[model samples]
Target: MTLAATIAPQLPYLRRYARALAGNQGGGDAYVVAMLEALVEDPRLFDGDCDSRIATYRAFSRVWNAMTTAYDAARDLEAPHHRLDKITPLPRQAFLLTAVEGFSPDQAAQVLECAPAAFSKLVETAGREIGAQVPADALIIEDEPLIAMDLEHLVAGLGHKVVGNPRTRSEAVDMAHALRPGLVLADMHLADGSSGLDAVNDILKSFDIPVVFITAHPELLLTGQRPEPTFLIAKPFDEDMVRAVISQALFFRTGEPAPAA
Candidate 1:
């Protein structure tokens, strides 16, 4: 297969990572486009020895780093004193590679072009940064008792309080309206066949809230057809992934808006 064909399937996922890492769809997509153009000009930039997925990400990393550095330089020249506007993206990128993209530490290290030990350090720093985030009340919308309990524990472990766990869409909406949670962790499907999407939509209409969807089939929601959840945790998710995503969602939404790439 051609190089384009080999990497085509990974583009959506790359876009997802870019969007999350860059903190907006437009800027993230721009970086992905630049990376693709660069690849067209120099195909050998792709590492043939590694998995195609890893190589694609590695190439994007180089593009992101280079472009962002240039962006920072220009911004610095324009406003030398506005240092607080910058978002420290490296730690978040490392966290996303392992937590959201499911890359192992070694593979994520290759993507970042860093030593494995260094990558571990990056993740550790990311964790500490995430841990320091302001606590927020969270609502858990899951039908499963065990999963709901697990999610509650996880959310609580991060110093956030769980306002409630609702089993159905109606209950979720009602609870959200009554409690006005700062965060929502929801399953796509509920026991009553009520859609979590519907409940979330109702809640969003009432007030703006950061949402993190938990589902087994994340691809179903990542269709790129409509506005979708920016944060997702796959079913049977590890504690680390849940913590990272929860912090990421809250960090982006509650924290100062990330300056556009």
Candidate 2:
């Protein structure tokens, strides 16, 4: 089946799952829309010999899992937060179908290729694991529109909120003053020639928000004395590293030990 043919019927379920995960109405809707587009481009994952409803649910689960992983990595690189292990073999299809997508346990078990009793246990365990992670509020500052949007998606996935996207150093500073965001993810380069360092200075002058600098120019490190608690992530990074960074930054700010350097 074509991607659209596979996913169009699942849109409502996907939206419900996204909203449940996001905890915010607007953000959940946006996230589902993005995931649907991604599904259309990669439909094979969702198209299979299984019954159509089961196949659709499996595909939706996969798309959400991929997006979460990608977004988590991006966020970690930008700001270090707590390090929780990856979700294990919880039968993604069963978990989604039984829990979030509202499939009956017997039906979900069939999709997961497992027994109904086992599927129920898996769903409960996975749900508990997800509920354990506490999402932090984040501030994202990037000049690029697409990158900013991706970052927003990632932040929301982590159960965090994106306070604002300030393209310029001055605007970032102003946002920091106004929002007092828990963490800041900033590109080293801003809208003007001014570097993120300018905004960093302003934030530090007024508050103690932690920062993770995203820069394409790693060589910029050679220019001057670097700040303590220095968190620097090179651009074009995979989402895993980003998640690690964000988890580390948040943990450190919360008086936890810094993630291993």
- lDDT of each residue in 1-261, candidate 1, tens digit only: 899998899999999987666555666788899899999999987887899999999999988888745233223322211221242567767877877788866788899999977876676566556645556778999999999999888777767889899989999988888887888999998999989988999988878888999998798789999998878878878665676677667655643321221
lDDT value for model 1: 0.77
- Stretches off by above 4 angstroms in model 2 are 1-134, 222-224, 254-261
lDDT of 2 by residue, 112-223 (tens): 5577567756654443343335445567889999889887775665556787999998898887777777778888788887788777887878766678877787667555
For candidate 1, what is the TM-score?
0.58
**TM, every model:** 0.58, 0.47
Which candidate number would show the highest lDDT if scored against the true structure? Answer: 1
State, as a TM-score between 0 and 1, how close model 2 is to the true structure: 0.47
Report, for all candidates in order, the number of backbone clashes: 0, 24
lDDT of each: 0.77, 0.61
